[model samples]
Target: MLTYLFMGIALLAIGFAVHVLKWNILIAYYNTKPKEKKNNKNTESYRKILGYYGYITGGIFFLLAFLEFQGISVPPTPVTAVFIVWTMIVMYYAQKDDEDEK
Candidate 1:
């Protein structure tokens, strides 16, 4: 059970990282697009949101890596399951948020 919790947390960290990478790539592509002025409000908003994701995901990855290195684990399966589900839901929302831009 504890192993599962560790594994799930590691997986959650991975999922978050994949998302951050995707968003950064998209942001870079958007920035590099041919445009005369780059001060548009929409571009600024997208950069802000991507910054938020990067900060949050980076922190999560750091914390999880520390926990994994220290071998920390929870005893309850239900809580771990909930965390994994919640992480997935968050990832879905993050991706959905980007869909409107497409």
Candidate 2:
């Protein structure tokens, strides 16, 4: 029972993060204007890339949760922890890119 509840919550958080990131990307893409006659000039590719990385990271976290829910032994969390940090560093660079463009 508790496992199910925890898994449900983890999945929900992951889903919500992915959904919000994608929505932001779509909204930014559609509602913006060309810069100097180039679509790439002012585009927020950083945010889009972050969205993708976020999806992958969140999915892995949710996978761990699912394994727990299914009564399967989850591997040690070190790899996942490293992956999370890796994603975070990429996200930091993405943010830097966004800032540099501004």
Candidate 3:
């Protein structure tokens, strides 16, 4: 129960930081790049997508925590699946080459 709550809060914080504050420090692959090569102008759209992902997943975690508090038992498998699928979608959008810009 507490685990879900913590995860939900953390995700929400990360989402707020990334989406509202425009902090890219928490992004995965993008964070590892050199500062001079970040080229954030070209990646704003993808970052927004990632931020949305965080918001959604965080909401799910919050809902799960609430449900658990209500004495409802939910399996973790479905949440795992959701995370995997959403992550794949976000990564695809983030890493896809921008042929139109060429």
Candidate 4:
């Protein structure tokens, strides 16, 4: 059950990445609002950054799900910690990039 949930999240993240990669407007680092879609700056860089992170996050979730499905003891703390750190790091860089262009 838990594994299924994780897999679902994994698929969603990967799908988001793919969509952003192809459309460059589906999801972005900062300009997510419909009104701001047409004014997204540094779109190429932001798209790549977001897509790569999404792929990485999806891969992490998929791995965790696989390990759990295989009867491996997967601790929630470690995964949660990693996700927190990852999100903070990504956000920092994304913000920096956004600010640098402004």
Candidate 1 lDDT over residue span 1-102, tens digit each: 345445546554544543444443455535665564344445555555555554554455456556756877534465557656865776465446556656
Task: Tell me the deviation in Å of residue 57 in model 1.
Answer: 0.4
Model 1 spans with C-alpha error above 4 angstroms? 1-26, 73-102
What's the lDDT for candidate 1? 0.52
Taking all chains together, the TM-score of candidate 3 against the true structure is 0.80
Candidate 1 Cα deviation (angstroms), residue 4 = 18
lDDT of each: 0.52, 0.55, 0.79, 0.67
Measured by TM-score, the strongest candidate is 3
Candidate 2 lDDT tens digits, 1-102: 344345446545544554554344333333454555235543446445645565665566667667777888766567557876886787577557656876
Query: Could you give the C-alpha RMSD of every candidate to the true structure, in order shown?
Result: 7.7, 6.7, 2.3, 3.5
Angstrom error of the Cα, residue 42, model 1: value is 1.2
lDDT score of residue 50 within candidate 4: 66
- Per-residue error for 78 in candidate 1, Å, reads 17
The model with the greater TM-score, 2 or 3, is 3
User: Candidate 1, which ten residues in sequence have the lowest lDDT sum?
Assistant: 17-26
Per-candidate TM-score against the hidden true structure: 0.41, 0.46, 0.80, 0.69
lDDT per residue (tens digit) for residues 3-94 in model 3: 78888898888888888898877877777766765885756765687788789889989999999999999888887797789879777767
Q: Which stretches of candidate 4 lie over 4 Å from their true place?
A: 1-29, 32-40
**Backbone clash pairs in model 3 (N, Cα, C under 3 Å; residues 3+ apart or in different chains), count:** 0
Model 2 local distance difference test score: 0.55
Error (Å) of candidate 2 at residue 69 is: 0.9
